[model samples]
Target chain A: MVVLTVLSLAMWLLTVHDANFSRMGQLGLVSILGWTYFVGLVLVTMGFANELLRTPLRKTWLLVFVLLLALYIFGTGSAVEPIASLPDSYRHAGLLEFIFQNGYARPHYVADFSWPGAFSLGSVFVAFAGQTNALGFTRWFPFFIELLYLAPLIVIVRSIGVGRRAAWFGIALFYTTDWIEQDYFSPQALGYFYLLVIMAAVFATWRAKPSPLFAGLRKNLHFRMARSRRALQLSRLKERGADPSPGTEPTSLSVFDSWRPRLVSAAKARRPKLVSVFDSWRLKPNPPIFGTQVVIQRRYVHGRVASLFARLEGRDTTKSLNTVQTLGVLGLLVLIMFALAMSHELTPYALILMLAGCLISRHLGRPELLAVAVLLALGWLSLGASDYWLGHLSDIFGGFGQIGSTLTDNVANRIAGSSVHQFAVNIRIYIILGIYLLAGVGVLRRATDSRVLEVVAVAPFFLLVVSSYVGEGLLRVVLYALPFTSLLAASAILPQQSGLIRSWLPDFRIFRYGRSSHTVIWTLVFSIVLASALATTVARGGNDDYESFTKGELDAVNYVYNHVTPGATVGTISPYLPFNQRSVGSVYWVSLYTSGSPTIKEITTGLLQIHAQYVVLSQSQENWGEIVAGFPKGWESRVFLSLATHGFHVVAAWPTASVLQVDPKIAKKG
Target chain B: MSGFLVASAASLSTSPAELIVMVVDFLLLSIRACSGVLGLRLTSRDSRILTSATVFFVALFIVLVVVRFKSLG
Candidate 1:
């Protein structure tokens, strides 16, 4: 109770700063603060003592009370600061400025060069606020988004029999992760949360039994009638003088009938017995169990393989396979792939042949042979072709190509003036990728059943290909591969092991460890470790550097908002600026806008038509310089160019690299 | 008349809007229960409405308090 109250108060104080203090709304502030503290205490106490609360109504009331308290705290804090006076660095600055000037608005611009892009729920929320000018929308909005992302992870852990404390730990790790932090200010992060929520909801529905409504709809009325007719037929057959058992020989039944009564009587006589002889003869046991058939088949196949190897080697091969063959195969594959990928002219044919030789040496079955052939064929076709058909194939099978493109782009950019540590980062990425790929293969090799191995192998390859395509970077491919590989490796190592090593891995016992409670401790530990590693790597790699750039953009936007007329549309050279500014205008500068659909052109033109008074260009060293150089001859004679040449002045410049300026005509128009 | 007066006092203690929402929530809950008993499945809208009604009552209570304080001031 104290913690919740303290946190709420702290957040409120941090957000409002001295805005409320200066306003002399001390009485209002005190009232709100007191209510917030009081309500927090009440809700916390109720939540803690929820088990003692007999009725569901009481528990619900407590939840509602907490929500209301949170609302009050947030609302009061939000109300303290005038929208116009808020710092430019704050996210949604343009929307806030619009709200201050126009009362309320929803977000308008859809597509932008922001993290997570515009086609997300977070962007929707931002757009809503910008378009509607509803200041109240900001309150409790982040919490809802966070809840959406967190709920899936919690449910997944619980479904896997993870304990409460561990689940909470995982949730906390998720909240504190770089992804969540990044999402806090950007609309794209919010979209990712929504995507996760949608996936979780789908998963939940899949896990549960079909909904009654769906079941009823699926159970055809005609089918029910037909079932009844069949039942009637069965009953009529029993009533007749014909044999009741369909498709059974009467002689077989008669033969068993002589012993049937004695068997029945003996079973009846032993009914009180705890262990009846007949119990063993029962067709199936109760306590219905569920397990993947694929896994069972894999285990069966593994047992067979172990036996075969034992016969071949004239000893138990388990220990030898685990220590020697596992490492050897993994190392060999990594070495082969690395060598092949690095070489400029390692023909797809040669690679496929090498893979085939490996498969043949491994004594893999015909199915494995066919699969490898197919994969190699696809790779070959992708590399050989350049036409449209080949392009499609290349797109599908061009993971390595994608990585090469990213490497080239990054390296070229670095060479052109960007400060990036390529070698160290790329190496780490490649190592992770190598490990991930090897782990997938290891899982396939070690899987007891061929079917299980096939299933696991196929999915990982698909994910690898898709991720590589989407990311278009070796580092990204490696990063994504890390989790998939870790999961597979962890599953393989822990399940069959015993004693000391088993203690180290995650499972029912290790997850619980020494704790008496039902918590899956190891899962929490794993999640935290993974999330921390990811966060550290992202931070080290300078992913957060984009935030600084965004800040500069926002500063430019603030200048425009302060100086330009309310209805005047502004044109910006950068797609990001226009999107972030929610400025509708004829954006002639960026390729993204120029090549966009008619709807985009319409939206852009609408902003300009409204009263676009300013044209601003951010002067970056690279692209910005090119844009400036491309300024058509005699451009200064034109009205727009003349305004820039004569009346426009740089308002703010960032480290003297980028400059934001205002046009004189904008002031005149206002 | 005494019973009616007691009922009116109880109702008055609750905000009119909140009480109305609570009654609606109660009715929805009862209907849902009855449907379950009759082996009839509730639609998504029914579930959403029931949930929304419960939420609405709580929201109404908070709104009432805010309105009352504002009016008093």
Candidate 2:
């Protein structure tokens, strides 16, 4: 708690007070201050860890989560002084404003209009609170959404059977490292909350029967065939006038004779097929399953794969749902699924994948849950989302299995620009790699009871195989997989138990340290938590180097919104300005808005042809060109020159943004 | 409730007077999500609420299909 509180206070003091900290000169006062913040963060995390390991209470962990969330999620945005950091938040607030004033989305316009649930929710929240705008909520939404994830996170970790200490620590680590920044005022945030709740609720409420569907069907089929064979034998015996009484079971000789042909056929089927290549795996009882559970874990070598899976995952062995509770949860599931289908594009699909994973793992009793998720996802995509996809079918299949490209977009591409930004990006990459490395170890260590859960954990990755969600797909897959991965990773420090690693890997002296010296272990964990928190805070807010707008920029945008006629076109070099606050009809960001790498001539011609009445040239727009689109360093100046030559004169100017007006009479002179 | 649902399907930012109705409509979505989890209790048999929810979802499915087909044709 102290660690988080200090981190929050220090963040507020350093970042909010030191406006030029991120862009400060090498080894300057601001740089010194930045270093101080990083060092302080590490020390505090260590202190928190020391306290957490000593205390017997789980509430300590929860308190730590809350505090870390405030410091990392909330503090990152709040530290940007008065204005909200991201330009998108301003647009979203405007979207809410428009919804409140107009009562519906402006369709056939704006990509976000198609997925209107989040905006509509914001409208209602602002109204219910009796506020006029969503600006207040927009600034601190990431914090609120992260806060909402607490209950479901706890339930999922515990259900996954991570030891209590491991669960708590892993969760803390997760909070510190989550730098995706998707928890903004967006549909995916709400959809994520729904997804977590549904998964955890399924875990808490019920489990499938010991006999899985496919296994039961197979057994029934075999029983019917055996019964027919026995009946045929009895008829043959009766015809021969031999005693084939019900009291007497089949003699060994008869049984051997009956099995001889089948045994010969089985041997013949297996005789020559065992080649040298896949010989080891050929006989390995691979899980050839379709929603069927096997009892014996390959390692355990004692029981059925179904029983093994059920036995290992403690949550998967719970009792069936009763009448009343069953009704309530199922009802809740439907409501959530519907809301998810409406609110977010990718989350419901993720939900479908995870639900199927649960059913395949025998964690869910009803096939109906999976069916509902599938139907809702497919129906929404095909019907509800037809409005978005009808004219843009190509958009759905743009990035298919381009792993290298996706990785570059999420990691490599982000490393360009300032050293501080590059450092933050590198840190984000390290923390992600760090957790998965531990999860790999945990899997070997038998961190969770059932190995099948690992398969379940990877289910969301299926989405990445085909679509990269327009470049950020892999990151989204990682986010969905975070809770499960964290659970497995936490098992690294999981006390000396029957871990998969412990069973397979011969005892190593290094693992002994995991079971000893609570003080040392906890202190190490605290350091990790602190490092991740620091990285996430830096990475999450690092976009402020460009994406953030100053008060003057917002004022310039407001001026455009108020002074210009409603239908007059407003243009920006990039969609990085907070200009769409009015949800007006004539907002046009240059070709660079939706497309990558617009040339200077293209920008000039596009704005000139549209006869854009007003244009914004902002620092963010320029930075976006340089870092993202590889525009020349003097692109901003060149754009200014182009506008000046095209009958455009500056109306208002600010350090961060400038508003320009184009005169039609003067434009003819150009 | 139906009126609110219908209102949610349209653009509300054009007029402020309808904000209250749209806001109420938004709350309906929240209420539907929150109530099920809060009211849920584990049972032996598929519960009565499950039946109601199934029927509700089936109805939702039909509504979506109808709306889509109507628009498509």
RMSD list, candidates in order: 23.9, 11.1
Off by over 4 Å in 1: A1-144, A161-169, A180-191, A202-512, A515-579, A585-670, B1-73
Per-residue lDDT, model 2, residue A411, is: 62
- Clashes counted in candidate 2 amount to 40
TM-scores for all candidates: the values are 0.35, 0.73
Chain B TM-score (model 2 vs. true structure): 0.38
Error of 2 at A161 (Å): 0.9
lDDT of 1 by residue, A553-642 (tens): 445655665665555455543343323333323222231232122332343343344334555443221232122223333322232343
Q: Locate the minimum summed-lDDT window of 10 residues in model 1 chain A.
A: A110-119
Best by DockQ: 2
Q: Tell me the tens digit of each residue's lDDT in model 2 across A1-670.
A: 5555666567546645555533522211223235545655664565557545655655755566446545644564555445666666777788668778888766666666666677787788899999998877766677778888888988876666566677777677677778777787777888899999999888777554333312222334445345434543554466568887666544433543454344333333323232222234323433233211221112112213334433333223454466457657877887888777767788888887887777666677554666567666655555445557665755665566676766666666656654555666676778789888887876766533344457667999888765767778878988998888776776665533653223344545555444456556665676567666766766666555466666777888888877787566777777776656665455544434643677888888888876678888887777667655767787988988988987888989987778898886875554
Displacement of the residue A51 alpha carbon in candidate 1, Å: 19
Per-residue error (Å), model 2, residue B32: 21
TM-score of chain B of each: 0.45, 0.38
